[model samples]
Target: MVSPLFITTFTLLFVFHLNHTSTVRPKMHINIYMYINMCSSNILTNDCLPPLNDENDFLPPLNDENDFLPPLNDEIDFLPPLNDENDFIPPLNDENDYKKFAIKIPEKWKKKEWIKWMKQTEEDWLVFNTYIIKKKKKWLARKEIKWKNWIRGMEKKWMHYNPHIYREFKSNTMKKSQSWDDTQWARWIETEGKDFMEIEWEKWIYQNNKYINEWIMNQWLQWKNKKIMQWLMNSWKCEEDEYWETWERSTIWEKWFNLRKRRKWLRWHNRINKETDQWNKWVKSKEVIYTKEANNKLLEWINEKRNSFNNWKKSFIDKWIHKKQWIVWIREKQNLPCTI
Candidate 1:
């Protein structure tokens, strides 16, 4: 959209320059006049013009999908396909499941030491079994003593009221007592004397250490394996955690070193400035004032409600005392009036 005046001025300058040069060389006059007319016509048509594409739009259109190379299918599954060899999760019952916990095995003991440890564990297990047996025996002896005392006490209680019943009970208990096992006694109590028995003798027998020891012995191996597995797992986790901590600390140290080389002073100054600004902002904040105002209003509301309730209660009690003339209120309330 060039101004017509600008175009006319530019044409006049071109013609004047050609005329001035032609006067010095009349032979070039015709050629110069033809060149001027050609230039003037090109300017009028606006054909000898600027480039079609701007600097930013200079590149050809990218219509090829291959040129853009659809961003690496990031969502595609990269994991290995499921198979029996790789698909199985290590089960707690699997013997090989203990391997995840075996990371620190070498750190804790050498091959020879591990062998010694195994031998020691075996010995300890045997000793523990023997101790458990002894404990069971002691517990059985204690239970027998307690059972005898309980029987004696029950008999004594009955002796004061019914000597005959106590005598019969005692006789039955004493008869074949030396040959009577807990199971036999249990059978006798359930079948013959269960109705007469005051105490739950069978329950007491089951609670005895003998039965408890039997159950413990049955599960001992599994329990030991679980504890060893737990120890191994904990050791492995602790080692792994220590490694992670070391890595994190080293990373922080390197970061701090790089920071010191670049903007340590700037960071420190910014931190101090931020802290001061935060303190000032806190001092100016209306949150504390608003909270206090809300609390005051809440307290006032609570006091008003309490006073209103107390006044209502007082008025109700006064009316009850003055208006209700019931002479037997206590008996009426209990609903248990006595008849004369």
Candidate 2:
């Protein structure tokens, strides 16, 4: 039930208040590009204003129209090919470049390409070589430190418990002993003469010379024997030994002479009978004893013998020899056939 004049006056007062407030408040200087970027496509309409070309705007200026366009095919065609060999390898003027080149070497490169890539100027080669030498030294130093630490750890953990380690240590000691020259031997004898001589004598007493036949056949031993004969003749010992009959000057000599006589008799017996003596001393010295390689070789020889025996059996059966002497042949060749 409001009057028309009162309604008109209220409308005019509201409009005046809005105008006064707008004039009194500070103007907001928004970037036109920012507004465009933030404004959603769905909300943009014909009512939206065009962007202003204000130089003082806080937003960056727009690039030209050509900047957004793709390059022409003709322009690309005028440029060098991307796969050019020269373009692939950048110049290695410094150590850093050399390292990078070495690290980034392509797996698929041809030998020729690799050679070409590796080729460098004298100055560049020096730098590269220096870098490589330094790197290798550092690597070796680190490796040596790691190896020392590992050895220390192993020694602490298994030095007393491991038999293999003890054996290896003994083998190394033997090698070092065998490698000693006259001076080193003299020095060692000076320091540990009694203990060393005792150990050596014990070993000599326990073990016979396994290489006696080889030693007898050695040229140096033959020369020494001739010299000994000359010395014996000059000293008149040869004349004195004429009625000795046996070279048994001492108990040791008599024992060795008896052993040699027995061995010679056994060897003659074996040759005459064409039978092997199982207890022959030379059998142990032969390469067929107590080693992995020897065992393998023995197995192979046995297999060959077995195969030959089988072939011989087949032949004997075809020839009707099996009917006549089957049991005898089988008994003779049961262990390892001499004929087959």
Candidate 3:
């Protein structure tokens, strides 16, 4: 027979297990509820119960879902209000007793308070000015270091390729030869002109000179654009200071001006008003002009090349064979025995 103590202990364990399982796994909570009902029914029937050696032997493992517990309701009340009759006593001092929460002081005290406020303001302004100066100097020094490093890097790259002798020499010997000299130089200009007419040669020379001039113009425009961009970046920090100017509020204006109008003026003054499109327009116009000029120059060069080629063909025929010589050469080619 099961003892009374063992039955009570098993009942307590079942209650605790049910309460814990109800929060973790609701589905297993139903099984535990049924098991609890069986235990109670057996107890009522005075059924004999087996002794449990361990809590685990009495309560089986539940499912693994760990649902959140419902939040507990707070039961404590807030602090009670103070009874004015028992706790609070009205002040019995005069209006000028130096304790009233008012901004307008008696005329006698105004001078002393004004001097104290002015002294504090002067100290604050001096500290702020010193900080601003230090910050500006630090920012400028950092930018100067970056600029110097960039210049040093560029110089290193330039020095790697350029010889120091070029700097030492002053005459034309220091200058590099033109790129075209590597191609035709003296041979083509001297030999090719012998067969061609003076007019044809003059036309070619003029066309070539025009091409060189157009190339030089392109290089100049590119260099000008780079310089402009560099200068703009170097001066960028100071370009918009006028737009950020603050409007000083005089005592009279502060007292009389509407708050809404003052706010509107502040908003307008704080915005950047400078037009950035002027530089964009200038760059666009320059690009369009350069593109058009380059196209025209290219077309002229192509036409000149075609004309020079035709002139060379004509001059070659004149220098070599006339109609009879050409016919004789064709007959000899046709009469030659076939190698096959």
Q: lDDT per residue, candidate 3, 1-340, as tens digits?
A: 8875676578769678556653324544455566556565555343333333455443434453221212223211122333432322235365433222121122223233334544554465356436544654564456446534643453343222223323432322213333333233233223442332334445644664565446545654665566445433422122212212323434557534545334433433332222234344545654554466645754565465557555654554443332222223223335753332
What lDDT score is found at residue 321 in candidate 3? 31
Runs of candidate 2 exceeding 4 Å displacement? 1-120, 165-340
Best by TM-score: 1
Ten-residue segment with the worst summed lDDT in candidate 1?
101-110
**Worst 10-residue stretch by lDDT in candidate 2?**
23-32
lDDT of 2 by residue, 1-340 (tens): 6565564555456445544443211222233233343343333444333334453322322354342233445322223444654554667687555543432332223223323422422244355436544654564456446544643453243212222432433333223555555455445334443243334333432332223223323533454345334433532223223323233334665545455333333333343233123212322333232234434543454455446434543453333332323223233434434343
Model 1 residue 320 CA deviation (Å) reads 64
- Ranking of models by lDDT: 1, 3, 2
Global Cα lDDT for candidate 3:
0.41
Evaluate residue 276 in candidate 1 and report its C-alpha lDDT on the 0 to 100 scale: 49
| Model 3 vs. true fold: TM | 0.22
Candidate 1 local lDDT, residue 41: 58
RMSD for each of the candidates: 31.3, 40.4, 29.2
lDDT of 2 at 167: 49
| Candidates ranked, most accurate by TM-score first | 1, 3, 2
Give the alpha carbon lDDT tens digit for every residue of 151-235 in model 1.
Answer: 5564444222232444655544433544665565445434444444423343444455345545554555464565345433554
